[model samples]
Target: MNRLSDKEAIDLLKHGDILELGQQANKIRQEKHPGNTVTFIVDRNINYTNVCLNECRFCAFFRRENRKDAYLLPIETILQKVKETQEAGGTQVMLQGGLHPSLPFEYYLNMINTIKTAFPDIVIHSFSPAEILHFSKIANKSIKETLQDLRSAGLASLPGGGAEILVDRVRKIVSPKKIMTDDWLKVMETAHSIGMESTATMVLGLGETIEERIEHMRRVRDLQDKTGGFRAFIMWTFQPGNTQLGGNKLSSWEYLKTLAVSRLYFDNISHIQGSWVTQGQQIGQITLAFGADDLGSIMLEENVVRAAGTAYQMSIDKMVNTIEKADFKAAQRDTEYNIIRRF
Candidate 1:
């Protein structure tokens, strides 16, 4: 059967015919990866600073520069986190932080270089579209130049945060200060044009229309069509706890339905992630049967989602058992989404 389009997707979504969507997407999932094995990364999120200038309504992680807990995480603390990640058998360190307005471009370059200099093997998958855009504007440099500099300093990839929803309508409402949809796409395209690959993510249940949700997928699909640099597409319900954009959490069924629709709709993208951080391990495991090929990460340490008061606990053994209970094999992967070890 042919996969559904926008209106068809809306119909499936409304009818909650997620099983049908799952069947359609699972066909493709099996076609691409024919096995019970699901992949995850051994990574830690090293939030360099919580001090942010663009305080989006949906974010509870960022604080003012002078706030009590806000900090720039002097390079030493970041290195310590990286060391801790490595000690725990982590292969990647996600260096995600806020858009600190006063930090110079050299600050970031030095941070990347310093980390790379110490732990040459750790994959430095850092920054989001918003950070990149901010870097471009603050450093008075071109986007290409900024990305290239980071790459040269040993940044491996970009985590696709700040892409809450691609439609300007929702973007303006939630994240007025963050980069526009076009600028976000442009950064990814430019990064891919060089040699870097990245992931695409969406945070749902933030007052966007169903059409807007599908449009978000369309934008990601279109960009993937152009740059083939997306390693996987991840979707999770937005955690609205301590932020200005307070709302009810989207149900697991709604998240799973949209995830299945994303798989069925975006043919070019190969991987979809099951976010245990926000969805809990049970549904995260169920996501595999629902068309997700990867189970996100064994985040040794995480703060952003934890700050939202929605965190799940999992060690490698627990992660493996969770997937096997769901009747899938569990595997470990690196930053590039490449399988390193299978269990």
Candidate 2:
């Protein structure tokens, strides 16, 4: 496939037939991953705390510091969750949380070290770019130094959250207080510089235009060209049910179309993930034909999306069956997209 210019991508996204777009994306997927296999990981999303300093308009998961329900998970409680994840056949834990004003940098280090010490083998895919920037501010460290410290403390990779859209125009409206576009890229670049790989994500339907969506992909593709550190690109429609950014959910067609366009545009990134967590099981299955080679996670626990009132549950057996019913083999993978088990 020829590399698409930004204008060409926007044109295709705005005027292309949904089925044809999906076909083009599926061709790319087949070329990249020849085998007819969809991969998933067994993981749990552990929110260490809900107390947030940045009260973004699009978030339903964050609480003010003084909220009655705001609480941080104790180290022992985190350990127990890790133990449960291990027993449930999980290979990774996506530990993310909102920015807390009072938690010192040492608290994060201790959390990472404690989890790694208890479960040496489980992949610790924790923290978003926003969280990293917060740590840097409080610790008085550069982004590179903060990433290095986290790596030394056993943070394997990043989850690519808090990146609603890379365009500052949309970002200012949705999550004004969070780190902006360049800061997010800097965190990923710094991580990649130190040999850590992470994924890139786009949360569409944030009242962004088609051009803006293409712009988001262009930024990610440009950074991938520089570092080649991003393993995959995942796009999900914004869930606005219970959030301050309330609007009707985007249609399944829009989700699939944007996802398909993302696959075609992000030619540099290797994998595309389908979000069953937001779109439900059937659309997740349809995504296999539309360019997703990975079905995201058989999440043992997910809270943020649940808080937004769009939760879909998937067990190991159900995940495999869904993939198979879509006429593809299902496989389990680790944080780095390495296949672990095939079914």
Candidate 3:
């Protein structure tokens, strides 16, 4: 295939035939992976607090600091969840939360230290760019200094949340109070510079133009060209059930088409994750043929998407079966996308 330009990507997204897109994407997936193995991680998403200061219009997961339901999970409760995840054979914990108004920067540092101190083996893939930026502002530090401190405190990697769309125009409408496009990229760039690798994500169907969708991918692709720190790229449709920015969900066809295009466009990035949590099991299964090499996680728990009124659960056996039925060998992977065991 010729080099995929921005105009070309948008054109395909707008008018590509579904099967053709999948075929082209699957061809790339075969070349990139060169095997019948599809990977998943056994992990849990633990939200420490839901008290956010920057209440984005697209979020249903955050509450004002003094709201009746607002909360910060006690350290004991957090540790207990970690214990449960460890007992369940989970290898990683995704510790993401809302931006609490008054939580000292030390609170996050100690949270990382506490988890590492207890579960030294667990990969603490925690925090989004927004949270890190918030931490820097509250603590009067630079983004680099903040990430360095978290790394010292045992932050293993970053979960690519908070990157709705990299276009400032879409950002202004959806999440004006949150960090803008440049700040999000700067956070990822800084993290990469400090030797802490992370993933990049796009939450589509936020009323962005087809051109804007490709624009988001282009920014990530350009950055990956420079830093090579982005280990994978994950794209999911925006869930708009209970949020302030309520809208219809994107169709499965659109999701799969976008996923396929992403696989073809991100030629430099190694892995593309199929999101079962939001897309459901069967569609996620189809993603293997649509250019996804990984089936994402058997999330022990997920609340953010749940808050948006779409929830799907998968046990380890179910995850294995989904891949098996799709004609690929199922393998458990770690945070770095290394296959740990095959089923």
Tens digits of per-residue lDDT, candidate 2, 70-145, equal 9999899999999999999999998989999999999999999999998999899989999999999999999999
Q: Candidate 1 residues 1-343, lDDT tens each?
A: 5646778777767786778878877787898888767898888988888988888999899999889988878788889989988998899998888888788888989999999999999999889988988888888999999999899999989989888899999999998988899999999999999989999999899899888998898889889989899989999999998989999999999999888888888788888888898999888987887789998888988898888888899899999899889888889998877789888
lDDT of 3 at 304: 92
> Which ranking of candidates, highest lDDT first?
3, 2, 1
Off by more than 4 A, model 3: none
- Score candidate 1 by lDDT: 0.88
Between candidates 2 and 3, the lDDT winner:
3
RMSD values, in order shown: 1.2, 0.7, 0.8
Error of 3 at 218 (Å): 0.5
On lDDT, the leading prediction is 3
List of clashing residue pairs for candidate 2: none
Candidate with better lDDT, 1 vs 2: 2
lDDT per model vs. reference = 0.88, 0.92, 0.93
Clashes per candidate (backbone, < 3 Å): 1, 0, 0
For each candidate, what TM-score against the reference? Answer: 0.97, 0.99, 0.99
- Worst lDDT run of 10 residues, candidate 2, spans 1-10
Candidate 1: segments with Cα more than 4 A from true spot: 1-3
